[model samples]
Target: MTSHYDWRGGREAMMRFGLADAPVVVIAPPPFEEANRLRALMATVARGLARQGLAAVIPDLPGTGESLTDIAATRLADWRDAFAAANEAAGPVRLIASVRAGALFDGGQGAVGHWRLTPQDGSRLLRELVRTRIAGLREDGREASSATLTEIARNDGIELSGHWFTPALFGDLEEAAPLPAHPLRTVRLDGDAQPADHRLAAAPLWRRAEPGNDLELAQLVADDIADWMRTCLGG
Candidate 1:
């Protein structure tokens, strides 16, 4: 079931699954539009974890999703602490489950390992977000440069695409790179893995034009994640 609790100067929401136990993999969310696209899949992953006799918590990272708090006040540290809170709520984190740019915030603070999905370098993700927003502005007949979209947060603090990014958040994202700390247990590549023939090489789910809950795709990905988690935790 989904639950909410005080976390990192805001309340974070998470969907808890099966025989809640210690050392959960707190699933760090992808930021902005990506989060909207991947939310269903993430929940499916938690359900898969339960089926595997493991517990997982898919958190609504601070300033996003159900926690619509002061997004402008949010920062990298707040996200890290939120991870810890989710871990504490479940116990020690066996793994920090992260998706896409979300891997940028993996604290590795108290985790035994990490599990990353569609892993992306931080700076690249930020640039992608900027590009996406810029294209969006063009569609609206607004000629906005990536520079303006990138720094407008410092001025208007407006919602870009779907979520708010404050100046502080913008700076952190611009500087983010692959996490330098955590030793990952697994990285499930979807569409990024080799050989175009691979099943995981399907079109990116998070980039879908229309919002969808691809339960079939979600379950397939979830089962894959569960299998990897099992391997990481040792069969």
Candidate 2:
């Protein structure tokens, strides 16, 4: 079902699953383009959780999804506060399930536990965006590098892909890292060498050129979350 939650900025849309009174898992989706790629997978996971008798919500942060806010004006702090507010509105939220860059703002919500899938730091994300921009410029017979684009971003702002990133947002991202929450469980795909509590054997859906769904991977993720939530709830 679709619901709305009011934050300090304004109200934003969110998708809810399962019974209204059940313990909830608030999902913090990956930032920007990655979010679009994984939307289907996230929805599938949310529904799977519902089948396990748990509630879940996927909120649209300030400048993302169906939000009315301007992306160029949104900052990292705004996203963090908005995420915290969303969690408060989702009744009885027991945990947060975040993917990639989503982990950066999953804290400050007071959730008992956090489950992240291949969490990524802001610097790395920024670099990826910069690289993409440079690639586009090269195809047009133009010259630009990460350092040059970053300098432009610092002085004014830069448009990477379709999003306009403000100087403040770029600066914030340069120093942002995923919050180290207590009782956190990090999961990664099999090929990733990064340390994780668990690793699944599935291709990264976010890497696909188009949005896709992986029912098998979604089920694995949902089951892991259900088991983790049970442990966190002392069951």
Candidate 3:
């Protein structure tokens, strides 16, 4: 079902699935372009969770998804606060499921447990975006270096891909890292060297050049989340 939640900024859309009285799992989607790439897969996972009798919600944070907020005006703090507000509205959220950069803001929701998939820090995400921007510039016969772009972002803000990021948002992202939450379960792709509570053999959908879906991977994620929720809920 589609619903809206009100935060200090305003109302944003949220998609809910599964039994209304079931345990709730709030999904914090990956930021920016990765969010687009992973959208279908996330929705699939939500549906799978629904089939397992878990209520899953994916909220549209301010400046992302179908939101009225201007991207340039949004700060990381706004996302965190909005996510917390969304959690409050989601009705006793038992777990937070976050992927990649989503981990950065998932902690403020106060869920009983957090499940992260290959969580990434802001600096690395910025670097990847800068590289993509530089590549686009090179293709356009313009030149820009990472250091120069970083300086520009720090002072005057900058546009990456299609999103306009303010200096405050840029600075916030540069220093942002995933917050530590108790009963955290980290999942990574099989080959990733990062520490994770579990590793699954699945391709990184967020890195794809085009948006796609993998039902198998989504089912795996849903199953893992179901198990984690069971443990977190003492079931």
Candidate 4:
């Protein structure tokens, strides 16, 4: 049975399955458009894990997914703390963190089971962050000049949306550490293991579109999660 519970500045919604005592898979969601895009995939993976005798909790971190916080007020530390709280609620947890969320495991934080999909390149992510911030400002009817954008990027106290953009978040992100030295399994995008250090557990990258359009990327992400659970849980 799937149920919802309020948790740490947010609500934790989860589905339970099989032996009431099974270990849990707590899924930490990705961010922004990616979260919506990957929702189905996360659900599929949760269900798949449940079928295999593992319970799963897929919560919308404090600000995302019907939670109290919106995109603007959601900060990186808030997400990290949310994951930790979710793990506590789920009991001994194996975490499936996707995209940018994968970075949370860097400092050996609340990690039990770790899995990542399409791990982001942190530097590129920062660049894209700038673009996103600028575009968001424009969309909000705020005049965004190149100078303004540069100033925002340089400052750590600027408010984008409602959250304070801090240099610490960017620094930690840029330093993208190795998956906390713990037992971790990963599946990468459709490419050979570029990171020679960690061998990818799965190589197939599912597609939601025929051959183009990034909008279809969500389908691929969802499929990837579903496939990973099916293979890992033998469901």
lDDT per residue (tens digit) for residues 132-170 in model 4: 677887888987765565456556445443345555555
List model 2 lDDT by residue over 1-235, tens digit each: 9999998999999999999999999999998879888999999999999999999999999998889998888999999999989898998657998999999999755687889999999999999889989989999999998998999999999898688899999999999999888898999999998999999999999878778899999999999999999988889
Better of 1 and 4 by TM-score: 1
Model 3 stretches astray by more than 4 angstroms: none
TM-score per prediction, in order, is: 0.83, 0.97, 0.97, 0.61
Cα lDDT of model 1 by residue, 1-235, tens digit: 8886666486777788777553466778787788888777777877777777777877777777777767778887788778667766665546677777887776646666666666676567777777887888788998987777666766666566776777777777777775764446444545464332124534577878786676776666666656655666666
**Clashing pairs in model 4?**
63-69, 72-163, 94-113, 95-113
Query: Per-residue error at 188 for model 2, in Å?
Result: 0.6
CA lDDT scores, all candidates in order = 0.70, 0.92, 0.91, 0.53
Give the number of colliding residue pairs in candidate 4.
Answer: 4
Instruction: Put down candidate 3 lDDT per residue, 51-118, tens digits, no spaces.
Output: 99899999999998889999878999999989888887887656998999999999655587889999
RMSD of each: 3.2, 1.1, 1.0, 6.2
Candidate 4 wrongly placed segments (more than 4 Å): 1-19, 70-73, 93-100, 105-112, 121-123, 132-150, 153-179, 196-235
